[model samples]
Target chain A: MDAKETVMNVLKDITGTDLSDKMDENLFETGLIDSMATVELLLNLQDELGIDVPISEFDRQEWDTPNKIINKVESM
Target chain B: MVNIQPYGTPEYFALIILFLLPIIIGLFNGRRFVNYETLFSLVFLVLTFGGSKWQQGVALIGYVIFEVITVGVYARYRAKQNNTAPFVWAVIIAIIPLVIVKVTPAIEGGKQSLIGFLGISYLTFKSVQMIMEMRDGSIKEFHPLAFIRFILFFPTISSGPIDRYRRFHKDYVQIPDKDRYLKMVDKAVFYIFQGFLYKFVLGYLFGKLLLPIVAHQAMLQRSAFFHTGLSLPLLGYMYTYSMYLFFDFAGYSLFAVAISYLMGIETPMNFNKPFASHNIKDFWNRWHMTLSFWFRDFIFMRFTFFIMKHRWIKNRIRVSQLAYLVNFLVMGFWHGVTWFYIVYGLFHAAAMIINDIWLRFKKKHKGIPHNRFTEGFAIFLTFNVICFSFLIFSGFLNTLWFK
Candidate 1:
């Protein structure tokens, strides 16, 4: 799946609740992700996308959304 | 102080590794499911109650003895009392040890060893909850091994999620299948390692790096902004608290949960999406839910029941209001005997009650009155309320405020 699809899918899976729009930023505030769920998300990305996410890359900005996480993973 | 410190040094590591000697034998013996908890407790006994310093060993021995006798007797006695008062009695009796430990001045006259309170605090809470349940007839037969394991689970021996007895009993008997145990182990390994990163790496590193600056600034009182700015930046440190607490406690809880799972038991979920909470009420509902549930069951219910029976007052404030007051104060006091803790709990109780009222009002009024301004304000208010509560609960701030 592409970045957008990946983002939407991960958010839906993690939150188990649909969101209003594209998963860009503020996933934490919007209740789409949390600390534990973020770890889960990281694991999912690693398992699914064949990307190694450095622990340092898991700041609020980076892990806030699938697009951001995807971009970070791709950059890595 | 019992001369044994919580911070494990080289000697501690050596002792711990050495303590594992028996388990190593158990390991070689094809230990077909050795309860690591029982072994750890024995190790702890060897280290704390049966080790080098006679005084230390005596203290631990005394501690274990007291727990076995008072809490032990209470557990058995409450199993027949068949009422709510036994729950109260157990809690009171449980906290007595904590209070004694906390109030007793260290022989060294230093603050380092708040011996017995933290671990035993957790121990007693679990024990008390168990006894009350047995009394209430919630648990029919108790496994002595599982009970010991539940009490002395080493990972959470430091901090805890305030696990209750009913959950423990339920989980212990319903042991997971082998495949599930392996899966839990995988998750446990991840959590334990991840928790180390969060607590030791992210938290301790930041504290070591910036603590000097923060302490120095606090001491100098350089300027108004200096303190707030230092503290704010050190929100990274505090964020580590949020981070550390979640990972550390969650990891530890997962450790116990996974281990318990191996032996076949499903403990209550200690955490869900806590920070994902939309409101303060939502936050409590998600965070430290075991403790919240216990307080509701043991404290809140009793207080409300008492008030209702007496018809304490007319519908002016509601029995629920009084219940919150007592329940939260009990919660705060459970943390410590300090005034700040008391106030902290009271604040939360009021906030929760008000939030409930607001929710009720909103529901009664009907329709989602979506106002961007109101929603933003609500978020800001909720966050500030939480922050201020933390400020009150804060270690340094509480001392400073008291001073």
Candidate 2:
């Protein structure tokens, strides 16, 4: 699977809600994930894909969407 | 020497406006008089800390120097290395003064710590945040002067809408254009007026006037409801004190933000219709937002990550529950090392855990109704729960039961 699929799967595992179709939607605003889930997502990303997003650098606005998270992970 | 508490009196507001006039004009003309602003902040700081509060002034200076050294050394150390021990030590050393200030009163039979000054907690929050961000490599440089300015920015110095270093630095460096500055001024005026209504008018009504009567009545009923002090007057006191707490603090916060805006810094707000919250979690997001968000980010998120990263807790639900307990317990201790405060923290932690369980259950059960009526009921339930929590927080129960 690609990086996007992996991220989506991780997010689904954490939030118990699929976001494959709503890639650009804000996870926080939509209540799909919160700070707890965000931390979990970061950890899962590290374990699964080795993308270590520091909690300090995790701006909710910048990484609010699934696509944004995928892009940020890719860039990193 | 004249001493002035920031936004303490109507005269303070008048004096601030008169002094801020020059900065306002400078901003209006697309210029930021940084030196003048700095001088203004120093003068206000001196006014606040000088005179009868000279001891606090001395303590504040010593405290600031200590923190600057600790954070500065940590920042320097973090530049080339990434050791968890040093980072933990940095956080501990930075909070040492605040911890002393908090614990001294508890240990010394309510004698205030000499090292404790007004806004010590707020200052420590900012300092610790800087250290944490530096550890994360988010803050690459630590300028002592800039850090001092951020710590003692005077407007929100005493109590904060706890502005972040990066956010404050951005606004401080960039002078808002005339249009944006003008809009800011408009908002500032509105906020200041709203502060007057909340603080002088409504807060005065609830806090100064009604609170005393209700408190006295509640005290008189110390033997009521099976000596549990659970009287109607106590209930009255709860709702009344809740309003007083909200208005008084929210008013002060509005004044802080309004003044920050006049100085061209967009300080984050502290309140957002907190009573309308539908759950404990939502209430936290709305009420004392900066402080709660600070706790959420630094304590809750950090603790959760630490636990998970260490694989100490396999169950995510239990991990979050533990995080909430620590977060609220620390918050309670920060309020003071009192039984009521600690119980208040535990109460909120319980509320949050229960709220989380309900939220999860709701998510699973599609049969659960979630319409306007249900939403309103949820809000009403949350409001009462919060008010009851505030009563526990007020320490009146201590007076009724122990005193």
Candidate 3:
């Protein structure tokens, strides 16, 4: 799968809900991913895509959306 | 040998504002008088640490020198290579003074440590944060001068809304434009007035005036309720003390943030509408936001990451629950090494665990009703739980039972 698809799958796995339709929605605001889930998501991304975003660099505002996550991973 | 507490009296405020006038004008004229600002900060620091508090002043200087060397050495080592052992040592060394300060009182029959000074906990927080960030490679360079200024930025020095190093560095290096500076001035003025209302008026009413009366009344009823000191007056004391804690701390935070603004540094705020929170988790997000956020990022999140990486706990829920317990227990200990503080930590940990369970259940059950009434009830329940925790935190229970 592509990076976007991989990220979407990870988000769905963490939240237990499909978030493909809400790519721009804030995962934190919607209660889909809290601090715990955010770590899980990061770990999953590292395992799946070798995208290692340090916790310090993870600004909640910048990475709050699936699309943003995809973009961040792509940029990295 | 005049001693002045930050925001302690009308005279202090008046003197500070007069000193600040030139910096304010300089900002308006699109110039930052860096040297003068440094001089102003030194004068204030001397005022705070001079005279009767000279011992603390000595301690503060010693503590800052120790931390700068510790963090500086770590930063230099981190520049060449990544090693866990050195980083761990750096963190432990950074906190040794604070540990000594905390443990001295507990072991020595309530005698304050000679090395202990006001805002020691806060300074330690900043130092630890720097070390952690350095390990992460986010703070790549270590400038001792900048670090010292960040640690001693006099406005929030005594108590902080806890400004981050990078954020403070950015503001210190850049001057805000005229329009932005003017808006900041407006906000600063508003915050000063609101602080007056919260600290002088409400804090005085609840903390200085009403708290003692309620506490005395509760003590009078110590013979009631199996001599447990559980009475109606005790409940009143809980709510009153909670209000006092919020107003006094929040008021002080407002002054800190306001002064930082006047200096063209945008310090983070400490409180939002914390009492209106719908759950314990939400309450933490709103209350003493900087400290809680600090704990969340450094302790809770880092602990979860460490355990998960090590595969120590297979269950994710268990991992998070353990993190909460550790996070809050550390926070409790940070407040001081006392029974009430420790219990306060454990109480919050339990509350957080229970809150998570309810959240998960509510998420699963779509049949649960959602409305304003339920939201209100949730807030009411959260508030009471928090106040009870604060009562544990207040050490009044210790006084009632042991003293």
Candidate 4:
């Protein structure tokens, strides 16, 4: 799987909800993930992806939407 | 207790100059900002502490001094190897003060001043947490000076989201560009004024006017209409408190971010529309977010790890329940050392544990078990439950069971 696939897979595991296409769905707003789950998400993204995302990237805009997070991850 | 310079004289002017100097400096240049944040914070330590509120200032200074020393120990350890926690030492130092004030019964005239220790509790935690992160190698090894600014940075100096050293270090080092710095300064100034509006205006109105009036009529006289009337307004006041909480905290966070921005340091956004949360768990995640993150990372993460590692509480109640109990209790204690705070945390933990059980029960089926209206109803109930817990936590709502 590509980077996007990896991110999507991670999100699915995280939210227990499908996000095959709706990448812009606001994770917190749509009940996909709560703040507590965010800790898991950050940890998983780092451990699974081999990418140590600085917590600074975990801002509202960047991490709010699936697409945004993927965009942030790709850029990093 | 936000040390507002009493409305008069040179002190007010001095405070304005202190805040303004940064803004002016920002517009002109962003160089020397890190130094400024550290220098001004130190100046704030001396002048503001020694100014009108010398007692509180001195206490803040003492904590800052202790936190610095503790962080230094961690920094020294890092020079040799990873896996040390200077914050552990600092927390011990902090607990000394917490015990005297908390353990001593008030009847015998215990430590009479919460104001003295106002900024110390939060700052000490922030300081030590950062040190621990440094030892854990989560954050880049910080210059001892920059770490000091991270601890005593004045924007969130009064009440805080309990910023972590790693987060602060991350933000500090990764300032995007000159334009980004300028944009942050703009946002930061906006937050400073916004902070003023929330704390003084909205908060004062709710606490002084709305809540007081309703609390008076409702408590003094007993009638359903009066009770309902008082409760309804109190709900509105709760929203006010919610807004007050957001603007007050987010405002301060912006100032810190902005100040740190001018210093070319990044700071995390503490609030992310938490009141819009539809669940108990979501609210905790959004609200007082820095505090939430701190408890999760340090207390909850560490405690849960320890419990599981040691097999401490193996009552067949499921590990999830244990997680909830420990998480909430620590979260409550993080808010303050008071009994009210403990109950407040437990209340949240219980509600969340129930919410989790409900989710698991629903998970037995397929997607979309509840209709939108039903979901909305659940969200409403959850929100109120949380608001009520916070009200109790704030020590405003007093009832026999709550204690």
Give a tens-digit lDDT track for model 2, residues A1-76: 8787898899889888888888899888777898799899989988999877788888888889989989988887
Top-lDDT structure, candidate number: 2
lDDT of 4 by residue, B1-403 (tens): 3345321233453565566576456534534465555566566556545655767766665656665666666666677765424446545764566455444444435446553455655665676576556645666565767766676666556666566665666665554556776776677667656655655566566656666665554444333453433455556545555555555556556555555544555555677677667677777777767777766666665554445446675542355466778888866665656778899878988987888777766765667557888878877787778677766665655441232
* lDDT for each residue of candidate 1 in B150-218, tens digit (9 for 90 to 100): 676553454565665555555554444556655754664465455456445654554555554554545
* Model 4, C-alpha of B99: deviation from truth (Å): 4.6
Pull out the clashing pairs in model 4: B49-B57, B171-B266, B172-B265, B172-B266
Error of 1 at B92 (Å): 3.6
lDDT for B169 in candidate 3 is: 96
For each candidate, what's the DockQ? 0.02, 0.87, 0.79, 0.14
Per-residue accuracy of model 3 over B1-403 as CA lDDT, tens digit each: 7777889765778899999999999988888898999999989888899888999999999999999999999998999988989999999999999999999989999999999888998899999999999998899999999999999998898889998899999998899999999999999999999999999999999999999999999999898888888899999999999999999999999999999999999999999999999899999989999899899888899999989988999999999999999999999999999999999999999999999999899989989999999999999999999999999999998888888
| lDDT per residue as tens, model 2, B1-403 | 8888888889999999999999999989988998998888888889999999999999999999999999999989998899999999999999999999999988899999999899999999999999999988899999999999999888998999898999999999899998899999999999999999999889999999999999999999999988999999999999999999999999999999999999899999999999999888889989999999999889999999999999999999999999999999999999999999999999999999999999899899989987999999999999999999999999998998999
TM-score of the first chain of model 3: 0.95
Ranking by DockQ: 2, 3, 4, 1
Model 4, residue B119: C-alpha shift (Å): 0.9
TM-score to native of every candidate shown: 0.66, 0.98, 0.99, 0.74
Q: Candidate 1 iRMS, in Å?
A: 18.9
Which residues of candidate 4, in runs, are more than 4 Å off? A1-76, B1-19, B26-30, B33-39, B78-110, B113-116, B140-142, B170-176, B222-265, B306-317, B367-372, B399-403
Residue B214 shift from truth in candidate 3, angstroms: 0.4
TM-score of chain A of each: 0.71, 0.92, 0.95, 0.85
The regions of model 2 sitting more than 4 angstroms off are none
